[model samples]
Target chain A: MDIIIKDLCKSYGENTVLDSLNAVIGKGKITCLMGPSGEGKTTLMNILMGIEKADSGAVENMPQNKSAVFQEDRLCESFSAFTNVKIANDSLADDTIISHLEQVGLGDAVYQQVSTLSGGQKRRVALVRALLAEKDILFLDEPFKGLDEDTKKIVTGYLLNNTADTTVVMVTHDIDEASALGADVLYLKDGKITL
Target chain B: MKNKSKIEKTIAVAAALLLWQLASVIIGEEVLLVSPFKVLVRLSELIFEKEFYSAVAFSFIRITFGFVLAVAVGIIFATAAYRWHWAETMLWPYMSVIKATPVASFIILCLIWLNSSSLPVFISFLMALPIIYTNMLAGFKSTDTKLLQMADIFRFSFKKKLVYIYLPNIKPYFISACSVALGLTWKAGIAAEIIGIPDGSMGEMLYNAKLYLATADLFSWTVTIVCVSILFDKLFMKLINTMFKRLEDL
Candidate 1:
């Protein structure tokens, strides 16, 4: 089922983040939201992911089972990359998790603590965690923010291969990245979608 | 550099012992200040005594039991307080009272209600409760909201959330609280035992030493207490770290 945002409004005190926004997020397809900073791209995704509430609007058909790669890595620092990914879905086979980590070029660092990993490596761990999780919708908030172009391409390819049938709502500033994922781009400006 | 620091620590301890010996010599009275040599001899003698093991065991068991109980209760109370504002409000005054009251006063007051054998357990629990509760509460409150939100999005069960997110996040705080509380529980528990004069306990040995003006015995018992306390603290902290390490591995 498609997620329908109807007149979604949110504000922190006087500064409105989402101003009566409305959009349709199609099921089983990638929808990339693009915008300049502070345009409520994250707020929209947060609302859709049920991390935040829209003050006076409704989000219809938001999937109960969802996964996200937050702007921050948010990986448990003391845990290894393999452990971080496995934490999302404990029932996943050890070989499958290791294969996913290897695909993202983390095979050598799979058992090293996330705290010791570089920024880009940590981002991949977060992405892997999100992908491994059982979910109907996947949210990626600038998931590839810290990666270099070469690494981002490989990671994005991995993401595309894994999430072919999963609904994905991604927020990014890079137009090329959105296009690379074959996403339907929606430009967010002043808290409204301008697709 | 680590070896250098170890040498420095050894030198410092030797200097302190030398100073203590000098003080003992200047006093010219064993009752006033027992020499390190005398204390060591007394410790060796005490070790040969049959009652020594029983006394040590008695105090160790009661104190450790109290500490373990406090740890369990403190975690539960902290979780409850974190989940409910009313629980926090209701617990505030009791925690405050426990923090503010003197160990001696609690020991005396508790003597009226509890038997001599149980005084140390109750006193140790009382003394350690507030520290564990406060630190664990802070830990629970300081848990990363971003990680929690991530957990939420991943549809994590309560057990998974606890093991992966909450426990790891609170590891430092829990360890620190235990470190502080372990030392305090020993001190308070011994003080209670001293007052209550529990038979077959370290406190009774100390009391007897004091009453007979056996300065060497007193110093030896004090040294034993210090050694036991340090040993338990290190062992407990190692256990906690190992447990956390295993959890992280999972």
Candidate 2:
């Protein structure tokens, strides 16, 4: 079933973020949300993920099981990459997590804690976590922010491959990323969908 | 991480000991404070006595038992309180009283209600419980919500979540609580022993020293307690760091 949002409005004190936002997310498709800074892209994702609530809105058919790559890496800093993925799905064997880490160009860092890994490696770990999780829907907020060109291609391909059958909503400022991920772009402006 | 030799540190400590002996000579009285050399001699003498071993064994067993019990109970209550707001609210006043009340008062009260031999154990438990609970509670509260949400989405088992998420988050706090409470247990345990004057215990020795005005004995015993406390702290910290490293490797 497709997710439908109608007449969604949200505000933080005096600042209006989303106003009467209406959109439809087709089931089993990648939708990339594109906006300038402070365009409420993250707020919308948070609302969809049920971490935050919109002030006034109606959302239909949001999947019960959801996963996300939050704005922060959000990986447990003291735990290894394998452990981070295992935290999301412990029934998974060590080899399965290592394979996923291998895909993200983090094969070497898999046995080391997220704290000791470099920035791009940590982001890949978080991405692998959300991708491997058994969720009906996936939300990614700038999930590929820090990777170099080569690593980005590698990880983006892995993300696309894993999320083929799941509905994905990604927030990014980069049009190239939206294009590379083959996501349907929704242009956002001041509290409204402009295109 | 450091390449410095352990022998250098040992030599430095020896130098400090020699300085202490010089100070003892200058003072010309053991009453004020016994030199490190004199304390070592006394400790060696005490070590050879059968009664001293029994005293050490008794004190060690009771205090350790109390510490272990406190850790178990504290973790349970702290986790419960973390999960339920009502439990935390109910425990607030109890923790406050435990933190604010004087250790001596608790020892005296326990002396009246408990067997004299059990007093140190009871006091150690009382002193340790609140520290462990409060620190672990703070650690639990500060755990990353994002990681929890991830675990929820993934349907990780309780055992997996504990090993991966909760353990890593609570580790530093657990180590810190252990360090703080270990010293406190020794201090409070000995204090209780002195008041209750349990036979074949360090407290009894301290009590005897007081009665005979053997200030050197008092100073020597005090030094022993300090040394033991430091040794325990270092060992505990080392054990925890190794565990964390292993977890990181996992």
lDDT string, candidate 2, B48-160, tens digits: 88987787778878987888889999999999999999999999999899899999999989988999999988999999999999999999999888877766766667876
TM-score of each: 0.96, 0.90
**Per-residue lDDT over A139-175 for candidate 1, one digit per residue giving the tens place of the 0 to 100 score:** 9999889999999989989999999889999999999
Native-referenced DockQ of model 1: 0.81
Clash count, one per candidate: 0, 0
Model 1 chain A poorest ten-residue lDDT run = A45-54
List DockQ for all candidates: 0.81, 0.61
- Among these predictions, the greatest lDDT belongs to 1
- B64, model 1: CA deviation in Å? 1.5
Off by over 4 Å in 1: none
On DockQ, the leading prediction is: 1
